[model samples]
Target: MLPISYSSLNNSRVNRDGSSRYRRFIPEYFRRIFHYPQMDIEYTFWIMFYLCFNPSRVYKITYWHKQTKNQWARDDPAFVAICVFFMAIASMSYAIAFHYLSFFHIIKTIFWAVCVDFISLGLVVATVGWWVTNKFLRVSAHNHSVDQNVEWLYAFDIHCNSFFPLFIILYVIQFFLLPILLSSSFLSTFLSNSLYFIAFVYYYYITFLGYNALPFLQHTVAFLYPIILIFTFYVLGVVLNINFTISIMRFYFGQ
Candidate 1:
């Protein structure tokens, strides 16, 4: 016998013949948690957006079907278009959400934060990872699809004569662009640094459920070192035209 999960319940069920079954999650709980009207819209937007942009890597078989009709699986132009759209949304959301947070900081309620942690963080990490990993791993579709720790190609198909991966450039933008975008003074920079450290320590503490070395390293990178690197890269690399992103892309995609 298997233990039943409250999360999985059937309003209609048949035991022996398997006539029919109803599937549902605790809607009341979801409603209660996402009670805010704005959040309801945000949630719907992100979820729908996620469904569209999200890569379905394990559906190689689906690609088999799609291949007969057309090839939109691996390097699908639609997928790229969706990526661009979602990237724009993500960037816009980041800007708006951060701007809101920077000013008000009123939405940091416990329930909301928990929702952000579990829903947003987990989904993004898992889904993104899965999508990237599927390109190589041939892993099951059930695995984390979003945050497979796979490097994305900024310009995978946009190489000059020969396409090369350029995700490092994208990453650099995410990593460092926040600062310049804000036009921060020294004090604001200090506060941002402080928040970074706080977040790092908090992430470590939560990750291990109390203790571990990896968390310490994670904290350092997330908080202190990352800022230093971003700052340095923005100033030195940009000024010197080092363009590590381009070089890295060349090496990665062999262009």
Candidate 2:
């Protein structure tokens, strides 16, 4: 007979066969979304700040979370709510700075930024990440009495973590540098492409960190492979003198 740790016993009550509790995660997550008193806004902001300045530190917290809470994914919706709020604010700032004064245009920009870019794309990326890790990266079940699988919500949490830094770079920092980045010069083009390159590289690197932190996952380096493709595209963009920021602006606001 083996001693069962408190964490394991607690997890058994919630997870049972491993995934039943996660099936109810969405509804419960949404239910708590509007329950502002329960949301840890300050801690969520701390995670957001570290995500930009010291991303590995953010994932380290995730590891601690698993040990204490017996789950890899966050049960609180505060982070999601804050992310949506920030995305909306950034979109509005861009619209105002770009002189998109019409009410409909502002609403459209916010819709696309929040709904399409953040939420919809996040769903696709999270699903892909969740499937890939669970399908190919999980340790063999025979190795442990209880099989461990990456949670879908955890995968989405990784996406949210990765996207925050990217949002700061492309949305916040890029906005301040637009006067120079949008100029018609080779240096401007290089700088713009470099910003995108760094943003995407950090995105994938943080993503790799998220999965690598899991005790049951292996060969997490596969997540970093996208950086090679990103670098290739960066070189092509520079060779063609393509300013990615301006291109994105054109796509969003037709500037």
Candidate 3:
């Protein structure tokens, strides 16, 4: 008879069949996101969006880590690709609505946003994250093995999936929140800023949880990794000639 670990016992909810809980198909992932446990609240991809929005989700992630001891993050490429596509479409739509971008400009903008913002940035951060984890962290064998440590592509996929929730929020901001900010009314202005601030905090906080989702990295290191990557991505943005401010201003002023 084998002994059951406390962690395995707790994760029975997600790992009931001793299989990966991550979904790879976009349709299934989206479909599954809506169904939560009636009382306990199962964390699905869609639910992760709301959770990512809430600052309190950090505690949830921490608690989840404690309960499941499952730190290997989900690696869902289809979902990540869909999020990237939606973000590009939303930005392009916003630009077209304001008459700021031609179809050709839209194509270029989409390429830059998808290639630089999502794919390239995700790769850089994930690669760095994997290096850090492989070097410094004491990962669990159940989470990842030494052989898996060299699989930077797997790390990249995990980070890409992690970007899904943030991308969804960005889509909302691009399509709806920016328009609200454009409103000259006092209430709109207040609400827009407040929402943006909330989203900003939530994005970083969830990203912190994501870094921790890499097995065995200290929580503090997890918290700091995302902050550093934000700066790194900004630098990459400049190198790629992608100015988020200028793009938004173009949308705002229809320049």
Q: Which residues of candidate 2, in runs, are more than 4 Å off?
A: 1-26
Whole-model lDDT per candidate: 0.33, 0.92, 0.55
TM-score of each: 0.23, 0.88, 0.54
Q: What is the lDDT of candidate 3?
A: 0.55
Over 1-255, each residue of candidate 2 has an lDDT whose tens digit, in order, gives 998899988978767755655546647777788789989899999999898888888888877888899899998999999989999999999999889989998899999999999999999999999999999999887754679889999999999999999998999999999999989799999999999999999999999999999988999999999999999999999999999988999898788
Regions of model 3 farther than 4 Å from truth: 1-76, 139-151, 183-193, 219-247, 250-255
Clashing pairs in 2: none
lDDT of 2: 0.92
> Residue by residue across 162-243, what tens digits does model 3's lDDT show?
5655565555654565655555565554454444344444555655555555454554355444556555655554455454
Best by TM-score: 2
Evaluate model 3: give its TM-score.
Answer: 0.54
lDDT of 1 by residue, 1-255 (tens): 998865445523334224322114433323343344323444334423433233122222333533484422222233333333444444344435344334233333222333443335545644543353344333233454423222232112111001001111232233355454333354434433433333333333222221111111122222223445555554554455444433432342232
**Candidate 1 lDDT (Cα, whole model)?**
0.33
Model 3 worst lDDT run, 10 consecutive residues:
36-45
